[model samples]
Target: MGIITAGKYEGQHPIHPKARQILLDAFDQGWADPTQISSQGRQAQALLDQARESIAKSLGLKVDEIELWGEPELISPIAIWGAPGFGVSPFIYGATERSEIIGMRGKSKQFFEISVDIDGAIDLELLTQTLQPNSIVAIQSANIETGVIQNIKAIAKAVVAQNAHLHIDATASGARFVKPSYWSTLHFDARSWNGPSGVGVFALKNGARWSNPLPHTRPTRAPNSFSIPLALAAASALEHWIADEAANSTRLKSLIERVRNHVKQTISDVDIAGNAESTLPNIISLSFLNVSSEQLVAELEIEGFSVASGSACVASALEPSHVLKAMGLLTHGNMRINLNHDVQDGEITKLLALLPGIISKLREN
Candidate 1:
């Protein structure tokens, strides 16, 4: 079998074919600085605005409420900063949220960690109890590594009842599911939706209390920062995804479920993260007892398959997955399967056939 991409395309998936075409066509049109007062610049500005409108329509937002960033790293902190409260707002987030989002906790502000159960579901009751009126709560719409989905609407309800704000990190599962209707601020990576790299999108809900977290003279809420071609590509891919979402999502969900069931029934002493009923349909996180993820990933690579082995965000660091550890699952021997929307059942079947023997041999060694 040929090498297959099981890595969830979030941030890593290549641009969709139609989106790639849009990107190529946009290069000439979007090359000029949209801020400039030239004819070419006006064309670029038009392309940028059109892209934003397309994305807005897909996500159910007005064009003015959205902003694009060329950098993904700073989106979380910046989005959190622009929320209802920043320096004074006591923040609370799930234990499994991305480091960038949770890292903001110690800007010398009060914070709380919403605990997750073994399945990586955050404690909703405890979260409600932790709410402080006029506070800010940061949370993941879905876990990137475990594919666990949160009851953010319920959390949002609690936050709103307390007169607080909600910042949702939908980077992992954005565009795969319906966009949440309730949020003070929302952040998503363009890469999450089969777009080019180095682009992220965020929105401050209309009438939501927000301000520029960074120093800027521009009246726009965000820096108006991003590659114009890439932004168009991202928006185009989102449209394609939305059009095909129902079928694609159902297929991806079925594939992940197959992988989950096979690993549990065939592989001994394996731990699977996330509950099938509540998790995203596209990702599966599995860990085998007494096996090394690094070694497993290498072996799988040699077998013409590529799977993620650690926290997706920090995989290059070769660190233990904070999410698995937080959920009390085996942090070692972890394998994450991110189903590409177009992946074949044969590919998964091949992967399934290889996993049992590979795990057995690794455990024996």
Candidate 2:
């Protein structure tokens, strides 16, 4: 099949050619333990430090504040509830947050979800009312499914006014958006920006009032010894993403609007989710009137175009998307399209050309 499914999900991008070369070149030293004092270990330590410094520079953070790990899902809980010495405080998140954030309910001291407007933005008024001193407020820079960017600066200000901490998940935003200066903590996945998988970075601002929640006998608090080559590759990929950010954003925004406008004009009983004015240029979530998301996905696949029926993070789930539900949008027949950073204009045009006929056929039957 001549398939084009770029932006299928996070880390789904084929490793950048430059990142692959970096990984290969560092393969030997990457295997050595950076903590050991041996010569080889010292070389590995140099590589690791370089990688960390590169990432820190990219995020505008100090080197010591960065922690490298594999899982993006685990970062939220650890940052929100695991900090040692910090007393359990209320955990608040937007209703449109990833399931992982919403799932923190049982694990937190007291978890609450703030409502989102139709555009999938956190209701700032409700959030203000819900804040408690020492509370941990988790908000993503951008919604993975809807691509709605949050007002993190405002949110962080409110959280701080209440003497609470804010954790911003920049995984979906990657290098596309800058972190708010007032954010207490932030995290991003390497794979989100066309880097290799199996690496993620978490950053805690100095004086952020967080400690490792996990019982620690080890000198280091990070859970895993990540692959040094992977870290280097990730940093390299991030550099490239940042360099291309402006052009990519402009091109992708134009292409996304093309599809959005075409679908609205040609299709029946359709609703486009998220506020276009405040969303990432890459992702769009659409709902159909009488189509089964599964069947529509299958049909699209047969046509050599791969699309997601719901959130890529929870594609295996049978229930409707929590993001759409929170926004009071139709949850059934939902499809999320994420345009790849390198996607061509022709690819988008091709998809738009096919959608009307495919959707009409599906609805008629």
Candidate 3:
């Protein structure tokens, strides 16, 4: 199939021969709410347990620390706003995240944005200055569009000194550079890890407290309706994918190296974002001197290559990526290339060979 634009299966489906049967078996047992504990629920619960255990083992965490949720956004809000007994807090970071944070603006008195350096990393000095009692600091482990990795270890320490909590959105960092154990220790009261677009895992460190951020009658904390099949698939994908990552990351790093070297050598005035050594191996964000990112993405797609401008999650929006803008870089001409394993080396070499010509041709237009 075409290069996967989705999760761990990026460029290829992660459904190995054995895993495919497991997934189908999960579906065959079919739609039963895992929470019910009936006969059907028992079957569903078994699947859920297997999924939870698999995901936990992959990340080096115990099963109970991980909680399943249907909504990806629910984890963040719940972690930030849930009652202490349930692991919620009133702390809010000054900088922004997504729809959930925006929705809470009117409800929070403690909201604040942490400043970033020119490279889009949180200014450690500024972050240090912002700490307060009972605060919860929200920071993404890696900036989505720029691939800028945050020093969560440092940030966590700073949060602790202030007697506060740390909430890391590891959507982009999970199964990449930050291992599951790193997250278990680094994440303070709560942290949200995105396993796939549809499945979200919110981990509450054993004793962290939170307040309920959202309203519901039963206080049903889980989101995304708890699908047994999707959870099983997601867990299966993560376990197998993590096992495959060491080799894959090495391969992906080589591909990105080619891009970095090719661009530096052939494309004058192109700005590559992030700390090259620390950036995510699979992603590179580059901006040509005078070209629009939209035009470049369209041109490349017409040439039978798929790439994204900024984060894939926000590509459809017209606004310049919050990530690039925050870094004080031009948002107009940025293109983020996220490499997938299915992408052949020949394709990357061809694209690299063709890029200079494409840029020159686009420049003339």
* Candidate that would win on TM-score: 1
Q: List the residue pairs that clash in candidate 1.
A: 11-191
Residue-level lDDT tens digits of model 3 in 113-177: 77676666678887887677666677777755667777777777787777676667766666553
Reference-based TM-score, model 3: 0.85
Per-candidate TM equals 0.94, 0.93, 0.85
Candidate 2 segments exceeding 4 Å error: 1-8, 28-30, 83-87, 311-314
Order of models, best TM-score first: 1, 2, 3
Give the per-residue lDDT digits (tens) of candidate 1, residues 284-310.
888888887778898899988888877
Q: Which consecutive 10 residues in model 3 have the weakest lDDT in total?
A: 185-194
User: On lDDT, who's better, 1 or 3?
Assistant: 1
lDDT of each: 0.81, 0.79, 0.63
Better of 1 and 2 by lDDT: 1
> Tens digit of lDDT per residue, candidate 2, span 183-211?
67787888777889888888888877677
RMSD, one per candidate, in order: 2.1, 2.2, 4.2
Best by lDDT: 1
Which of candidates 2 and 3 reaches a greater lDDT?
2
